[model samples]
Target: MTGSFAVTKHAEGAGVIRLAVRGEIDDEVSDALAGIVANAAAQPGVTALVIDLEKVRFLAAAGISALLEGRAATLQHGCSYQVVNARGVVHGVLATTGLLSLFQTTIRRTAAHR
Candidate 1:
């Protein structure tokens, strides 16, 4: 069900940032997601920003917009971006919207991220 939305930022390595998202990504949390991504991607020396959606249960229009926004910000900052662990409805929405290719989906979680 409707779990409270949250985004947790973790520095996975020297130039990589991992944002682990939990719960639903809807209108209520889209802005926060965009802001976090923008900020992370803007960080000096950050070369990659990974969004881990393993715990995301729902994906809405606003969420997709936020994701697109995040991708733009990452690109603007010259940082690579990717989405991982999305499944079920979340995965379906991304694929249907043609964002699955945009985000460069890497569904499997690496041991280092766990």
Candidate 2:
């Protein structure tokens, strides 16, 4: 693999838990991500979950499956789920897989200096 995946968790909003994922998400890393998603949903007051895939370099089939499972887990928990901040290759994978419309995604913007 050209890259490794790492996950970090943060409370981005009231009742929202954001799981920020970095690097490649192939077979080796997808399972771990599912666990994170499940844990986030089980947290008290977490009515919504967002998986930030902005930094993901590669997303394979396993990764996509994990995300789908995460969405299902959220629904089972009576919470809302979304995947945001995906760009380039990551975004393309989601689009081609027809998953882009399944979850809510927003482009993250950075400040520009003139």
Candidate 3:
């Protein structure tokens, strides 16, 4: 089934890029998400990348891999990376994959309630 997703970027001053993502994050959306993060990581002055996943409903392995790849790309460019607002199944997947501690995560209520 086709999934829906959206990515909105907010430049936080000279070195931070905050990307807010919503909806399903699966194989269909991983490539696009990776592209966004990669482009931001490649920016000359960007030193930090924050991926906000509070509104995400599902995250497949492809999506997790994309995040890991983005983290590596950011680090290579001397930038820090963080994934926030992961909860429920998303959180479980990350944790089960032993990536929970690898990325910064913030547990928050789902967007539907807010």
Candidate 4:
């Protein structure tokens, strides 16, 4: 509701880590996001990292910074990274900042067709 945040890791493909982020991402969780992404990227057999923000309701500037930092870390580690499911305000912020290219952006579609 107010300031809740959570990150859950899910395995993807042969070497990928998908982090599903939920709740508001403000100053408090921004640092945590960076740390989590860095650690996950550094883990063995992790060649790709995905930050799914479909459930994220509110994303502040700090959160944007974290995503940028996380992308840098992934590139530094030679690991592919992408942030998906960014819609509404999150999409606007990322688009306005020209980060859509940095992190291959994609929306999470509901299960209806295909």
For each predicted model, how many residue pairs clash, with residues at least 3 apart or on different chains? 0, 0, 0, 0
- For 11-114, candidate 4 gives per-residue lDDT tens digits of 86789889989998889889998999999998988999989988898889999999989999988898999998998888888899988887998985533224
Residue pairs clashing, model 3: none
Better of 2 and 4 by lDDT: 4
Q: Is candidate 1 or candidate 4 better by TM-score?
A: 1
lDDT against true structure, model 4: 0.87
Worst lDDT window (10 residues) for model 3?
104-113
Model 3: per-residue lDDT, tens digit, 17-65? 8888988888898888888898899998888998988778889989998
Q: Model 2: residues >4 Å from true position, as ranges?
A: 1-3, 109-114
lDDT of 1 by residue, 26-97 (tens): 998898899999999999999999999998999999999999999999999999999999999999999899
lDDT of 2 by residue, 1-99 (tens): 634688888886789888889998888878889888998998999999989887898899999999998899889999999898888999999999888
- Per-residue error at 97 for model 2, in Å? 1.0
Which candidate has the top score in lDDT? 1
Q: Cα RMSD (Å) per model? A: 1.9, 2.8, 3.2, 2.4
Stretches of candidate 4 exceeding 4 Å from the true structure: 109-114
Ranking of models by lDDT: 1, 4, 2, 3
**TM-score of every candidate:** 0.92, 0.89, 0.86, 0.90
- Residue runs of model 1 more than 4 Å from their true location after superposition: 1-3, 112-114
Candidate 3's TM-score reads 0.86
